[model samples]
Target: MPRSHWLDPLARRVLQATGQLPPARSSATSNNALARPEPALPSNWFLDVNRGSQQQWRELPGCTDDMADLLVRLQRGGVQFAAADDLFRLLDLPTDLAQLWAPHLVFNWYGDAPLQPVRSCIDVNNASSEELTSLAWPDQRIHGLLRERRLRGFRDLADLQERLCLPASSVEALIGRVSFGQRRAGPSLPPRG
Candidate 1:
C-alpha cells in the first residue's frame, strides 16, 4: 500500500524535525544527480598470473574452486603463462568465462626474482659447459649441443631442439627455462672429454 499524498509532507517534516535526514543538505549536488545511484566501486588492481595466489584468483568473477586450485598447482609446478591464451588453453576455460575474467588477469613474467627459483635456465648458446650440463638433459644431448654451437649458434628453441634431437616433450618442457637471445661470439665451451 502506498503512503497517502497528504502524509508525504508530514513524514518529511517529522524526519527534518528529528534531524535524521536534513532537508537542503543534499542540494550541494543537483536533484537530478541525487536521483541516480553510483553504479559500482572502482578497483585498481590487476591479477598477476605467474605470481597470483589461489585466493587472489578466486576473488575474480568467474573462477571456480577447481580452477583456482589448478592455477596454484601449475604455478607451483613451474608452469607460467605467457599470455591469456596459455591460461585459456591449459585450464580449458570457456570463452565466455575467460572473457568475464580477462580484465583482471595479468601474465607478468617473474623470472629469477626473489623466492622464485631460476630452475637452472641454462642458455645453450651462451652458458659454459658446466651450466649446460646442469640441465636435466642426457649427457649425449649436452655434449652434442656444445659441439654444434661451436660451429654456429642456435637460431632459436626450434634450432636447438632440431640439432639435439630433443623429443617433443623435452622441447615443451624447455619453453620457459631456455631463451634464444642473439648468439654472442664469446669463447666457446672447452671441449668435453
Candidate 2:
C-alpha cells in the first residue's frame, strides 16, 4: 500500500507538526504522494559532551560506569569534541554502543544546564602539554607542537596546520576556539608542584 494510505489526514498533520514524520514524497508522473522514510525524532536525553556529568553519561543507553568516567575525564581534560564520531574514535567505543548512543550525543550541544557559558578551545602556541590533552590531542602531537613552537613559532592558523600536520577539517572545527596570538615562545618548563 502507498504511504499516504498508511495514516489518516489528522495523524499526518500531527506528526508533521511534531517533526515525528518526514515530508511526503510525490510520484513523478502522478498526483499520488507517498510518505518519505520516517525521520528519527530527537531523543529525549540529549547529553552535551562539554558539560554532562558521569551520572548523566551513565544514564545514556549502553553507557557503562567506566565509559561514563572516561567521558567525564575527557571533558575535564578540556577535550572539545566536534561530533559523536570524534568521541567514539577517542575512546575506541564499540561500534554497537556508539550507534545506540549516536542519536543522543552532541558536542557543546545546548540543553538543560546552569546559566553559564562553556568555552571549548586551547591556544596551540601557549598551551602546555597537560592543557593540550584536553582536546585529546595525541601526546606526540603535543610534543611536536611544543618543540616547533619554541623554534620558529606559529604566525597564523595556517601555520598551526602546517607545523603540526593537522588536517583542514580539524583546523576548521577550531575556528572560534583557537587563538593565533603573538605570545612569545618560552622554555618548556614542568608544571610546578
Candidate 3:
C-alpha cells in the first residue's frame, strides 16, 4: 500500500495500543498562561496610611521581624488603617488567617461567611429533555420549548419567547438561570477535624 494510505491506519493502531492519550490542557491552565501576574506587594512605607498607632494587633508567628518593619514604616509615615487589613490585601491572605497565625495571635476576628455555591444552568443546545425537566422547570411545555429553540439555533435569551411556544414569562424567568455552558459540580466537603 502507498505510504499516505497506510500511515493514517498505522497511526490509529499505535494510538489505540497506547490505551488513552494524555489529557488535554484545561481551560483554567490555558487562561492562566494568558493572564498577567498579580500586582507586587507595596514596599514603600511612605505610601502606607497605618503608620504608628498603638493598637497592639496580632502578627504571624515567626513573621515578627517582617511585620515589625512593615508596621514601623507604616506608622512613621502616618498611615491610618488597620495593619491587618493592609497585610490581608498585600499578601492575598488565606481564607482562614487564624490557622496561619495560630499559637501567636488568638484570632478574635469575625467576618461574613464565604459565598454559597451557585447552581449553573445546563447547555440548552446539547441537553436532553430529561435533563431540562430535571431542573424543576414546571412542565413538559418548557422542555418541548427548549427542544424547539435548540433546533432553530438560539441567538440569545430574548429569542426564546419569539421562536418557541414557551410563555413569555417562563422564558424570561429562565433567561438569567439558563446558560450556554456546562454545569459546574457542587463544592466539595471539607475534611473532618
Find the candidate with the highest lDDT and give its number. Answer: 1
Model 1, 121-182: lDDT tens digits are 56678887777766777887877887898889876555666677665446546654665556
Candidate 3 structure lDDT: 0.43
Residue 34 of model 3, lDDT score: 60
Q: Candidate 2: how many backbone clashes? A: 3
Ranking by TM-score: 1, 2, 3
Clash counts for the predictions, in order: 0, 3, 8
* TM-score, predicted candidate 3 vs. hidden true structure: 0.28
Model 1 scores a TM of 0.39
Per-residue lDDT tens digits for candidate 2, residues 1-193, read: 6576666888988997875665555575234333343224346768777789998887665577777775665455444566665566545579877877788877774433322222575676787677777765677877887778878767655567666777644554554455655666467656569
**Candidate 2 accuracy as lDDT:** 0.63
Question: What is residue 53's positional error in candidate 3, in angstroms?
Answer: 53
Best model number under TM-score: 1
Q: Which sections of candidate 2 miss by over 4 Å?
A: 1-42, 109-193
lDDT of each: 0.67, 0.63, 0.43
Per residue, candidate 3 scores C-alpha lDDT tens digits across 54-82 of 23332232334444554454334322232
